[model samples]
Target: MDINLSLRHLRAFVAVADCGGYSAASRQVNLAQSALSRTIKEIEDELAVSLFDRTTRRVSLTAAGEQLLLNAREAIASFDGAFLRFQHYREGLSGTVSLAALSSVASILLPPVIFEFQSLRPNVRVSLEDGFAGEVVDSVMQGRVDFGITSLPRKKGRLICEKIAADTLTCICSSRHRFASKRSIEWRDIEGEDFVSFALSSSIFEVVEQGLRSADVSLGNITKARDIGTVAGLVSSDLGISVVPSLVLPMMQFCEYRGMPLSNPVVERNIYLIYDPETPMPPASTFLMDLLRRGPRSKFKIPNGVRWIDYPDGSCQANSN
Candidate 1:
């Protein structure tokens, strides 16, 4: 394993033999003619055989040279392949990175981040597919995509989840709602309200239920919404107050009342970037992750009368940059 035989000698031999002369091989391998000649001579000396028969007018491969040429080419290819692999890691912006995500993210934050990344590195191809929480987690574990961006702390998976953002669930309502003017709210107020929410099968529904039950209250006559946007739209139209992630509130075109910290064990979900530790992430994916990091630009703001409490690593604390 410690043998000193090198790729340099192999390349010199192959180039000289293939190019039919040391001078042509020099240009092929980007070496001076004298250097090329010396390299071949050293290789010949090490092999203890003259590889090429050189004449005043021409040079051609000998029996040993012709035979060794194949192995030399194979060695050169392997070395070139190694160099390519190193290049893959050295610069990540030139490759393709695909991700599986919860559609909710596609509605709010994922677009700007994906767009900025693409604009920053036009060569990198970014693709996203939508799936529910369980499906997204499974995709990441199965190596279906580079990673999954979804609500965090996935209960079941052999996955590493890192919180990329924190999202607070808010009870949104029309401006005419009885409690709409209140600066602060509690889950006790939710006791008598009819709820228009996602189905029990939906992840947000689970979060809402857990928050309500923690407050010793039960929601009445729940209606199922298939998507968050629809849920928000209905809530704005006074269908019933619905709860959703905080990041969603700012982007809504509807003039809806949004607020939070439902005093009874306020339940907030951490948005995590999920990946399988067992799989090797491509460098382009890592570059995207580096772009995902929060910076000094992150701070809590009351966007459209909605102020959220974000954990240190949560999305509200994320720098949109």
Candidate 2:
């Protein structure tokens, strides 16, 4: 048996097994049907064992195929990692990392990270996508993006999520807002105010709604939009006041502001970088993650304070001023 079987052959085999048949696997792996079948045959010939027991209606993994699945996954991961390491060593720094983040973080935190990331490693390319925090998490879990930076740690399981920052949540109003002059407002203070919310689809909105409900507050005249930036824009135009993470508060100068910590129930969102443990990351993503681990604390290009607090349970608090 020849050990000269290429990764493509193993990939073809796995695709067929995963997709239920060669025809489907060909589409999944983006190989032509004939090419896919040929590669699988080559792999079977190399190993001198029937990998898949194929029938007209379905494809099933035989003993050899079942045995190969685990090794094939590991082999693929190793190959990808090797390419990444090679790229890292060759250009001293290379790879294009794809990152998706919450709209707020994209506006405030991402600039310096991108700037520092690119300046430190000139060869690496970075693409940034912004969307709902949940969408960002979904992107990371689905392997559509290498990493996701989001403001809420609402869900657990599927992917590994770590707290990168304890982002403060704030209530923002436009300059013309009637309550802009108030020193501080309670949870019930703005309940009846026209509101531009962080979309009904956002789990952040749900978290906020829970808090509001706990305090017996109800939102009014809610306008739903997809991202925080849109919510902020509408707020700035006097469309309605909205609740947003405190990190973005510094960016809304045209909007009137008071940074009162929500009390009777303080609201803080722990932001995280999410990545899939089961899926493999490319070289660019691996290096970028490494740099994140070693670099100085990330700084935002705004005047916001993110002072740290020690949570009662010994976890860090959202105060990084």
The number of the candidate with the highest TM-score is: 1
- Compute each candidate's TM-score over C-alphas: 0.67, 0.60
Clashes of each: 4, 9
**Model 1 residue 308 lDDT?**
27
Q: Candidate 1: misplaced stretches above 4 Å? A: 1-90, 153-155, 254-261, 295-321
lDDT of 1 by residue, 210-249 (tens): 7877888777777788766677777777778777766666
Where model 2 places Cα greater than 4 Å from the true spot, the runs are 1-92, 153-157, 237-239, 250-261, 290-321
TM-score of 2: 0.60
In model 2, pairs of residues that clash are 306-319, 306-320, 306-321, 307-319, 307-320, 307-321, 308-319, 308-320, 309-317
